[model samples]
Target: MFNISEVDKGDSDLARLVSELDVFLSELYPVESNHCLDLSAVSDEQLRCVIVRDEGNAHAGCGALLFHQNGSAEIKRVYIRPEYRGKKLGEKIVSAIEGIVSEKNSRLLQLETGIHQQPAIALYRKCGYEICDAFPPYTADPLSVFMRKELP
Candidate 1:
């Protein structure tokens, strides 16, 4: 089992995971296909991040939710350390983020994951997020798979 808590974007462990997530994306996709949010964008007050850690307090993964002025938020920067994969930590992180979104009464939660990330895509689908048309700040990119789920 893992503990999940909301943390600032500048939190040391979260920052490190963000860096790792960026590096992983860079290795998998070309520059144009990479639509990750930079540090500055993540630092925006409108965004909130959550970190997952084992009982030993070691960082296992991190995820973020970007709150827009409207009643919607975008899920971003979700990553689990390689060793932590296959434990369903990613799904837990997404559920935790969804709880936060629900608290804010956000009507919808959306995310943009790379087309090559089949596992990630499957996770979102399992969480009830369906493939949808790209939204703001994101165009119709061949390499991007946009998904959204309506919150009850």
Candidate 2:
């Protein structure tokens, strides 16, 4: 069995996972193209995060949501451990984030990922997100792929 639950971004296990994600992104894109939030920003009290744990209670993956005052939210720090990738945990993490968005009354959700990240892009598309122009605090970048989804 696997469990997905809301968690603090500062949780030690989640932090470790985020660090690994950072490294993974850094290796694929230049610093400017890597929009991942740093530890401090991601740990803000208002940020909502979730972690996936396997049957034995080991952290398998993590993701977060950053809400904006405009009734929209940005998805961030969604990372699944390499060893745990094929079991649909990513879909579950995304579903959990969407649930939180609905509870908060947000209808729009968006994210920015690297252009080279085909798998990530595919997952977002599968989850009902569509490619879109860059949103606020983001600009058009050859290396960035922006997407958004409107929830009913």
Maximum-lDDT candidate: 1
Q: In candidate 1, what are the lDDT values of residues 1-152, reduced to their tens digit?
A: 79999987879999899899999999999999898886565446688889999999999999999998777899999999999999999999999999999988897999999988999999999999999999997899998999999999
Give residue 82's error in model 2 in angstroms: 0.8
Residue 59 local lDDT, model 1: 100
Per-residue lDDT of candidate 2, residues 23-116 (tens digit): 9999999987889887565446459999999999999999999988677999999999998998999899999999999999899999999888
Where is the poorest 10-residue window by lDDT in model 2? 37-46
Give Cα-based local distance difference scores for all models: 0.91, 0.90
How far off is model 2, as Cα RMSD?
1.2
TM-score of each: 0.95, 0.96
* Residue runs of model 2 more than 4 Å from their true location after superposition: 42-45
